[model samples]
Target: MRRVLAGLVAGALLALAGCTAESPKTDDGAAAPTGPPCLPAASAAASPGPAPSSAGKPLPAMAVRCFDGGRYVDVAQLGNAPTILNLWRSNCEPCRTELPAFQRFVTSAGSKVRVVGVIVMDSRPAAQSVIDDKQLTFPMLEDRDQQFSIALSQVVGRSVASALPATLFIAPGGRIVYTYQGIALDDEKIRALTAAHLGIEVAA
Candidate 1:
């Protein structure tokens, strides 16, 4: 009986050892059954897809309507004044942040350039709130139809089609001289650019 019991115990110990040995190894070579799959470091650094504006071309002409005193005004009749057309949306954070600066530029350099706001992809009420909150003195054009955006995109470059917060610097002759997109325009930059383009000194 003693011999039989001893043999049985020995067999049990061997079986347990075999089961433990079959477990997955841990980092320290200890037994661990569950872990995430490891990936090669080089594969993690692979490049992503193409960037915005990778098409390498300008946008097509887009016609837009202007909002003037609850009436729709034609874009072509926007007058002969040197104009700064600012394309903005109500929900865009950059647009909201840069609006005050644009307002200041309009206030200080009103005589030099006419700053017009084009509301793109935004409702009238939402845009009105921005105008009221920021106290924007310039006319805010209603571009809910995206016509102006399409038109201006053609003038700048095709890459501008997918970009927002674009500004077109239209000369007195109705030609676009400067175009900026995806950036907040501050007072100093606006004043300098406008003064240079309009050929007049912007009063401090």
Candidate 2:
């Protein structure tokens, strides 16, 4: 009787451990992303431009690592396409709300524009969990040391490093056309902004 009880307890403990452990695979047996499986930054590289100013400008010459341990994405080199750079953090409640809207926009817009997410001042695992939970597959970069933030602030001509959920609309020439800060953006707003700033139209 004692042996059977011990065996049952051990089995229960093992089952609990199995339930509690973070699995590398999801329910469908597909390997789950340990980090944000962001797409690689655009390959078309632009020559390094002058520093950004308050007026419409290019992304500051800064390099940040892709979350998936891919190549260092040069900020200035993203001028190959019209890009939307979204800044987010895992701990921000509004970021949680707005990320899905961005995902929807990505689906609706298709290749009309480029959407990139930058996770600032957040741990890779925490950001990865959010991306997994949200099913977000946008190109993502990590600004763990806040280098991108300072560069962004310089580009926008304001101290925007600590702000969560900011969006910058950049033209193909790498000039920043608009900067949206503080508010959480939905699909309609994203579309409107894209149309207004980047001059790209999508269905209403």
Candidate 3:
């Protein structure tokens, strides 16, 4: 009973903070299934599958799926700008709030920072539903097997933590300078984090 109450409290706090909950499961005790249908896309600029070679190391040489382009591409080939890779899923509660904020940040940041979205812990349809609902026009990818999440958790502290709604700040040479472990990362926090850690000042 105490454990259940603790979990409920934690969930409520996470929802308030706009963070993904831990290990969402289904009725059959399986992983949570996809959410809903993806809305019509506004542009044709999504990326394809990116299989990261090193989960927790510098930018992994991987290939991710792109929805708009309808093909796969190498993650290292995404572009040269310092990147902000955000992991999310359709079924994630906090993702409902965080993704839109990320979209706004991407639009305002322009070419100054490379912002990419990677769908985690969800089916393509469900993840697409969140994208469509949020009207996000950023680059999207997928990590269906949770390899990146495991790798990242190992790197951070050897704890098996889910990487959904997490943000990785990669420097120019693909060095991951910092990783935001919390939810509720808005434009202001993103800008401050980049400047403080990545040394790049993002203008308002």
Cα lDDT tens digits for candidate 2, 1-204: 999999999999999998889556533354444665555455443322233334477778767777776457777656767788899999988889999998898888777777889999987678888998999978888887888888888878986667778899987767888889877888889999998887778775
Better of 1 and 3 by TM-score: 3
Would you list the C-alpha lDDT of every candidate in the order shown? 0.62, 0.78, 0.64
Summed backbone clashes in each candidate are 7, 0, 12
Summarize candidate 3's per-residue lDDT along 84-184 as a digit string, tens digits: 87887777777677888788887787766667777776775677677777888877766667776666566555422364578887665555667886766
* Model 2 per-residue lDDT at 71: 55
Clashing pairs in 2: none
TM-score quality measure for candidate 1: 0.64
Better of 1 and 2 by lDDT: 2
Question: How far is 71's C-alpha from truth in model 2 (Å)?
Answer: 2.5
Provide the lDDT at 77 for model 3: 54
Q: Residue 171 of candidate 1: its Cα lDDT? A: 60
Model 2, runs deviating above 4 Å: 1-36, 39-55
Task: State the local distance difference test value for candidate 2.
Answer: 0.78
